[model samples]
Target: MNSTKCQKCGLTNFATDLECKRCGTSFVQKTRNSGSRPKFSIIAVVMFAGVAAAFYYVFTGVQGSVDKVNSVEANRVNAQPVLPPDAGRSRADYDRYRSQTVANAVGVSPGLAEHANRTQQTDKAMDQMTNSRAQ
Candidate 1:
């Protein structure tokens, strides 16, 4: 029987033995191709593709919502008030007229309309007070 010398411990072993007796070194040459690409299972590939698609869908939906918000803001900025600018009209009168118009359009009861008008007046008074204090 041919004997092979251990590279690590220098102990001689039989050719038929799988490992060095003294050092536990494997004698069999590895047959794996080091240059070959790693294999991915079909399930792994599908999962990766699904994740990519989900991200794409989420990004697109977010972009669409952002576009809608931008469009709505643009419309609000560009919109003209129902009443024309008149020097004779007091700020209170203008607010009352605008609120009445809105109430008429929405078909609200007279009591609710009066409450809305009072709320608008209160808000305007508070805003004026805040501005005066700020100055």
Candidate 2:
């Protein structure tokens, strides 16, 4: 069989021998393969890309919803109350003026008017519950 030469002892040794038989010198070579990292497979790369894309999609969708909520809140905060010059002269006059303002804001449609009324009632109920709990 072909043999390997031991560098330290200058002795010929069998290729499978870990050390020189004559001087007991180690003949083992450190493998280069142990230091190299394995390459990523195509399936692993595709899975990572898919997860990243899903995260991006979810993030943008949530951000868009947050932006819409912020815009609506800004509009509500910036809205000016509509009132007549003669408003608040008496309780009855004030009530009529308030009703007119609400009607204008909620639209003239019967369905819209009912919806607005229900929303107002819901707000009142929630406020009552909160006040009661506070007490």
Candidate 3:
């Protein structure tokens, strides 16, 4: 007795069966594979590869820029100011140099400097008055 295996239910049936007894699947029309890649699948694979390559290119470019920016920031953070040979030799010399620099800066706008001095004097007088009243 020759038997045929049902493709859907894996059940053995008689060779004369038109459908599987267990699953009711018809064996009359059978599906065939042609051993070739489908056009849609090939196009999908190509599109996926192109998208992956584009993402890789963008990621590498962004990583390079981030590295460059980090290096520049590290350089800025580690950088020190260049000083003159005679600068900061003694405390008096440093103080004198600092005062001269301040004077030069203030000389650019004398009225602003004068206003700042007046404000300082007024603050001192107010402090003195408060201290006297507290005492």
Which is the leading candidate under TM-score? 3
Cα lDDT of model 3 overall?
A: 0.84
Query: What C-alpha lDDT, on a 0 to 100 scale, does residue 46 get in candidate 3?
Result: 92
Tens-place lDDT digits, model 3, residues 1-135: 578798888999998888899999877664223234355678899999999999999999999999999999999878967656884489888889899998888877888699889999999999999999999
lDDT of 1: 0.83
Candidates' C-alpha lDDT = 0.83, 0.83, 0.84
Worst 10 residues of 1 by lDDT: 28-37
Indicate the residue-level lDDT of 75 in model 3.
95
What is the number of backbone collisions in each predicted candidate, taken in the order shown? 0, 0, 0
What are the per-residue Cα lDDT tens digits for candidate 2 across 28-135?
542234346577799999999999999999999999999999999999878967656774399888889899988787796788889878999999999999999999
Stretches of candidate 2 exceeding 4 Å from the true structure = 1-36, 80-135
Q: Write the per-residue lDDT of candidate 1 for residues 6-123, one digit (tens) a residue.
A: 7778889897887889778877742123236477699999999999999999999999999999999989978956766588989999899999898686566777767878999999
Sum up the clashes in candidate 2. Answer: 0
TM-score for model 2?
0.37
The Cα error of candidate 1 at residue 73, in Å, is 0.6
> Which candidate number would show the highest lDDT if scored against the true structure?
3
* lDDT of candidate 2 at residue 6, scale 0 to 100: 70
